[model samples]
Structures are given as C-alpha cells and as structure tokens.
Target: MPSLATTETLIASSGRKSFRVVFEGFLHLMLLACAVVSIITTVGIVLVLLIESLQFFRDVSVWEFLTGTKWSPLLKPQHFGILPLFCGTFLVAAGSALVAIPIGLGTAIFLSEYASPIVRDIVKPLLEVLAGIPSVVFGYLAVVFVSPIIKSLFASADLFNAANACIVVGFMILPTIVSLSEDVLRSVPRSLREAAYALGATKLDVTIGVVVPAAMSGIMASFLLAIARAVGETMAVTLAAGATPRLTLNPLESIQTMTAYIVQVSQGDTPAGTLEYRTIFAVGLTLFIFTLLLNVIAQWILSRVREKYE
Candidate 1:
C-alpha cells in the first residue's frame, strides 16, 4: 500500500541492516578462529614438551634432576643434576634485575612525570630500538665489547661470564620495563596528583608517595615479565655466559644456564631420540614452566590492579 519510493527505501534499509549483521557475525567468527589457533598452538607445544621430557625422565630421575648440583649430561659419567643450571640462570636473572630495575624505573618516571613531550618522543623510540636488536648481536656485543671492558676493570673476570651476560640482558630488557612502567605511571589519575598538590605535596613527593603506589601493580608485573624474559633468553646467555655448568654464585665465573644447555644439545651433533636429545626437551620444559609461572603471576597482579582501578 505504500508509495513506490517509500517501498524501495524500506527494502534498501532492510538489506543494509542484514548486511551489517552478517558482517559483524563474520568478524566475530574470525576473532574466535584466531583465539582457537593460539590455544591449539600452545597445547601442541606443551604436549611435545611433555612427551619428550617423559622420555628424558625415564633415564634421569626427577629427584636427581631437581636437586643435583652437577649438569654434565654429555660428558663422561653423565651427571644430570639441574641445580647448577638453575643457579646460572638465576644468577644472570638476579644480576640483570639489579641492573635494570633502578635504571629502567627511573627512566620511566622521568618520561612519564617530567620530560617534555618532544624529549619523550625522541628518547622513547631510541630506547625501544635496543629491543629490536637481534639477540645474537647482543651476544656478540657482550663477547666483543662488554667482556673486555669488564676484564679491564676486574682482571679476574672470565672471557665468558655471568656478569657480561647480565649486563647485556639487562640492556635487552630495559625497553620492556621502561615502556610498560611508563604506561602504568601515566595512567595514574590526574585527580590523585591534584589532590596531593592541594595538600601541599611537592611533585617528587606526589610521584614517589602517590603515583608509584597506584602504579605498583603494573610496575611489578613489568619487572616479573622482564625477569621471565631474562630467564628464557638463549643466544645472549649461551654465547656470553660460557658452557660451564657449575653451582657457583660468583658472577665473574663462566657458567651455563638452562636455555644455554638446551642450545648446546639442540645442535645437529646430537642424534635423534637419544638421551642427549631428550635433555633438550627436559630443559625446555623446565624453562617453560618457570616462565609460565612468572607470566601467571604477572597476569594475576594485572587483573587485581584492573579490578581495583575499575
């Protein structure tokens, strides 16, 4: 009963609405597919690690692997204790944390609270450029440059040592800490700053007392993630930290991390399905578990922070 023009308009509107609904459904399906792919990939990796690690543990008892201080799996008498690797890994991680946390946090605070926009824009990108450099390049840099400098300062330092690796890995993780912590610091409410200012608080006092506490959750999350990254690092650690798997705390001594051992075994020299080859998966699984725990903790902290802020 409507006029011809009115009927055509109605039809066009209905068609457009139908098209929008279909398009939205397609987008949702695409997103779901992407999520499923990621889940499947993670499951696949875990399954592979578990299967291979089971084979490894069949020969090397979990008790020995967890508590043993020696880690010479390929050498004569094949000691399979993983504690030395743990020590080496944590030595680099702790040293890197010491080097990175103060400097990275200070840089983030400066960028977020005080730097002019132009200085921030220029400096942040340059800092992030450090992140983009290849890990192998960092390894080479530690060997070729950092080691010599350390040796010059401390003649007792090994050519390949935990200290050299720690310095390089700290630089490697600096951008992550700076970027994430800066974002968190900037996200602190302007109202909070204003309130502190109203009470006669200086800018420094407001930042240290108010903004930092507000952003602590996110800052801690960044620190955990950076240390996790340091734990899982391979080439830089392997090349700079040497192949000696020893249970010593001296950063100047040559030592091997878990990831480094995996690398050493994963080279084409190790035959397929052998005990040496299986050690790779065992080490990989250990590294994976530790990194996963760190990530889980970071996520938990972030979630709590979000709930508080929201």
Candidate 2:
C-alpha cells in the first residue's frame, strides 16, 4: 500500500533488521564452535587416558592399584599403591589452602572494605602480577630458595620435600584466591552496607559479619579452585618434592604427587606402549578426574551463591 520511496524505506529497514538477526546468530554460532573445540579436546584426552589406563589395569589388578601400600613402579618387585600420591597431593592442597585462605581473604576484605581507590589500584595490579609469574620460575624458586629455608628450620626436613612444593604452590595460587574473593566481595550490594551502617555497625563488624558471610560461597569456590590448581601442579612439585612415593603425612619428608609421578615417568626413557608409558596416562587420568571434580564443585557452589545473592 506504500508509494515507491516509502516502500524502499520499509525494505531498507527490514534488511537492517535481518542483518542484525543474522549477525547475532553468527556470534552465537562462533561461541558454539569454541565450546565444541573445548569439548572435543577434553573428550580426546579422556579417551586416550581411558584406553591406556585400561591396558594398565589389565596387567595390574584394579584392587592392587587402588589399595597397594608400596608404589615403586620401577623396582624389581613393582608396587602400585596410589596412597602416597594421594597423600602428597592432599598435603600440598591443604598447605596451599592454609597459606592462601588467610592472606587471600584478608586481602579481599581490605580491597573491598578498607582500601581507598589509589591503594586498590596499586595492590590489585601487584596481586595480578603474582599470577603472571611462570610455573617453572616458581619451581626454580621452590628448589633454590624455599627448600633451603625449610630444611634449615625443620630438623627432619629433606632437601626436596612436600613442604617446599606446598609452600610454592600456595604462593602460586594466592592471586587466584585474592582476586576472585575481592571481586565477589565488591559485588555485594551497597544497600546492604548502608543498612548495616544505619544500624550503627562498625566497618569491621559489617564487613566481617555481613559482607563476608554473603560472599562466603564465592570465597569457598575460589578456595576449591585453588586446591584444584595445587593438586594439578607438576613442575614445582617435581622439582621440590623428590620422586619418592611414600605414604607419610610428614610435610618435611620427601614425597611424589600424582602429577610429579606423571612428569617423572614422561621425562624418563620409557618406551611407547610400555607399562611405564601407560602408567603416566593412568596417573594423568586420576589427576584429570580429581581436578574435574573440584571444578564442578566450585561451579556448583558459585551458582548457588549467586542465586542466593541475586
């Protein structure tokens, strides 16, 4: 029913709208492509690990692998106990949490509640810089600097011990905890703070009692993710925690984590298709499963927390 110019204008508007729809569709498709790539890579790795671990289980009983007390795979009478590796990983993860939780939460509280704009600008960047340091550099520092100090302080400390690796890994993951926790704390509604202030609550009281509780889920998620990071760390553990898989809780004694064992087996002269080669894949599978579980738990906690707060 439109005239020629009016019809052209209408057609142009339709075309623009169509183009916008197509562009949005394309953007969504691109995001799907990224997700697909990630899924494919993860599936491929899992499949490889599963196959190799099946082969390993064929030679070594599942029960033995799971329950054995000795773990000397290269010795004449090979032992395949995973307990020592689990202990080492837990020690490092626990130690990392001990180090990261206090410092990280304190930093987060300071940043969100106490710090002025200028102080925050300086501190946040410095905290991020900690994350930027290479894992290998941290490994070197653990071996060269931390190990000696630990050995000096502890009478029973081994030159290469779980303590050194745990301390170093803790430092490495500190930034993650601090930054994520700070962001979560900062995201709390200003109205909440104002209400507390109106109630005559001190800044420290409001921050510790209200804000921290509100952000507890997010902080917990950060801690779990940091634990996952510590568990999966390889280089620092390999360099600082000697390649001795022994089931002990003594932090000063040398130990080998699952990741460190994988690194050891991979870097050695183990031929392809051999038991040692397969063992690395098995260990990798275990490490992958552990980290995946931690991440899933973290995500779950984060979602629940967000739902509550939002």
Candidate 2, residue 239: lDDT = 89
Best by lDDT: 1
Q: How would you encode candidate 2's per-residue C-alpha lDDT over 84-136 as one tens digit per residue?
A: 88888888888878888898889889998999999999999999999999888
Off by over 4 Å in 1: 299-310
Error of 2 at 304 (Å): 6.9
| Clash count, candidate 1 | 0
How many clashing pairs per prediction, in order? Answer: 0, 0
TM-score against truth, every candidate: 0.93, 0.90
Root-mean-square deviation of every model: 1.9, 2.5
lDDT of 1 by residue, 1-310 (tens): 8999999999999999999999999999999999999999999999999999999899989999999988888889899998999899999999999999999999999999999999999999999898999999999999999999999999998999999999999999999999999999999988999999999999999999999989998899889989989998999999999999999999999999999988888778989999988988988899889888878878887777652554
Best by TM-score: 1
Residue 242 Cα positional deviation in candidate 2, in Å, after optimal superposition: 1.7
